[model samples]
Target: MAGRPTIYDVAERAGVSKSLVSLVLNRSPSVSEASRLAVEEAIAALGYRPSRAAANLAARSTRLVGVLIDDYTNLWFVDLVRGLRTTLGEHGYRVTVADMATAPPTENPVEGFLSMRVEGVVVAMDVPAALSDPAAPPVVIAGTRRAAPPDADSVTNDDAVGARLAAEHLLSLGHRRLGHLTASGGAAVVRRASFVEAVERSGATVVTIEHDGPTDEQAGFDGAIALLETHPETTAIFAANDLMALGALGAARQLRRRVPEDLSIMGYDNTPLARTRLVDLTTIDDNSFAVGIEAGRLLLDRMNDADARTGAGAGATSDGHARATHRTLEPDLILRGTTGPAPAAAP
Candidate 1:
């Protein structure tokens, strides 16, 4: 009457029970022809339209979204999840994460997510080879390019730009002798490659130490020690991530080099650790929160398109599978106390 008509109004107008009206709306065969006609007549009079969200509810929609990550120790996921949850929660979905490092080998993380009946998935790490199936659920990959499935939408950082920013920063400070501490991963490889190229373009020296172990503090420490010991003239260091940069700080301390006075260090990811008063690490801000928001939007689009193809409650019409989307965000440099002009050489 006052606003949009509801099922309750339709039932009251049709002189039937609310349950019977629902049965008609959902097209249940149990409703008699006479009752169906009565409901249709009542609906035509009131112009009642069912909500897709309500329809999904009646259809037993799961309303859950799963996120996959390699580990929890990486603080970079903190802001990413914040942005992701903000977007998905507004659309009536909850986000759940699976740490692949802790999952048993027998049960694939994707399988675990599917067993939980998640309507969609967001992969913040590498896309596993086992997930190349054609019938896989809707997915959005974050920060991966090479391993991304054909149908999965992707959101990634502009590693070339980010690495260039790092290189230019160090070079601007007169850091001719540079050292890079990195680990194994697609993101790491891209960053390392770009950083090396940018430094090489200026005819500067770059000593890269790639650790075979996990990308953690210890790897950073070991790599830094090796780099500094082998390239003692190296005046600047760039770590792959904030955790590694923190480890580099420790390495510098153990080696008796005063930060930004005797040596300058920079890191990537601009994680919360870089913002701390103690660490104060100069790093590249990958804009991961924005990447997460865009990723959430992309996954929603994929899920909605998939639903339309299967005649789901969400309204849309398309003939064939939707095309995948790929988005990349540019990164910025955050200056802090960790980096400075190259110190005067021993004279």
Candidate 2:
């Protein structure tokens, strides 16, 4: 009676079996609504907490997945994780995330997951050369343009198409002198190429396409300032990502340029920042959530394939040599307060 509440105590108090309580705790959809509610109420009243360490030991498998991301402050990854959990949780898998931005320069971040014996790994950041041949768990790359690993799958939005959409929208809004704020990366290259092509096709002048240091607000702000200083005729600016677009907003305010009056700003990724009242940036929706879902689905497929091959006496190393898959989801333009008809004359 003097011990911490356990699942047994919760089951007895709720008048339910331990297995039923476990199912409810696991969030299995098969459990009846009434039974689920009863178990939840009992656990809440008794303050019973499940022992993850004990459960992992008993199951003989961690049922854990690792997600490697570049920056946690970037809200695009937040949606990607939400989508991954939506699908992964249904299969009794839990995700543990690591920020590569904070890792030691010489260490391979994925090693942390491998040491924990994760069932799979999802890479939302650029894949490093050190992790090119991760042998065991299935791998999936999300929201990246890099080619998949030998046996991995990649899911991303079409950056080129999204960029073209942005360009065309700006052109339609009477933007004749346009600028692009970008950073160095494969995705950035594609977006810049498409944006340039669209501007040329529209018979408009591309005033500037600045390659900022990093894809962040500071880079965006610096690039925007540079564009404004060098090419004051630029009426619109399209940033490679949402964070960069926010930087453009700062530059506009600092330069005494009214948004959608003196300059129209466009950002990509349609992150939460773009939708906020303070930073209503018009941008391309990369559909990162869908990309995450696709990555999770592909990883599940690869895992299932491995299980099948193992059951048929195939070796664990065999799947890594299998053919890889590349899936691209479509992106769309989202209109907001940041972008509007170009100014009649540049101020």
TM-score of 1: 0.81
Q: List the residue pairs that clash in candidate 2.
A: none
Spell out the clash pairs found in candidate 1.
none
Candidate 2 lDDT over residue span 59-144, tens digit each: 55666889988777778788888888888887778888898777888876777888888878898876765456646577888876
Encode model 1's per-residue lDDT on 56-152: one tens digit a residue. Answer: 6448667688888878887878778887898887666789988877888797998888788787888887787755666677889888545878767
Q: Against the unseen true structure, what C-alpha lDDT does each candidate score? A: 0.83, 0.80
Global lDDT of model 1: 0.83
Q: Given candidate 2, what's the lDDT at residue 99?
A: 86
Off by over 4 Å in 2: 1-59, 104-107, 134-136, 315-321
Q: Which candidate is the best by TM-score?
A: 1
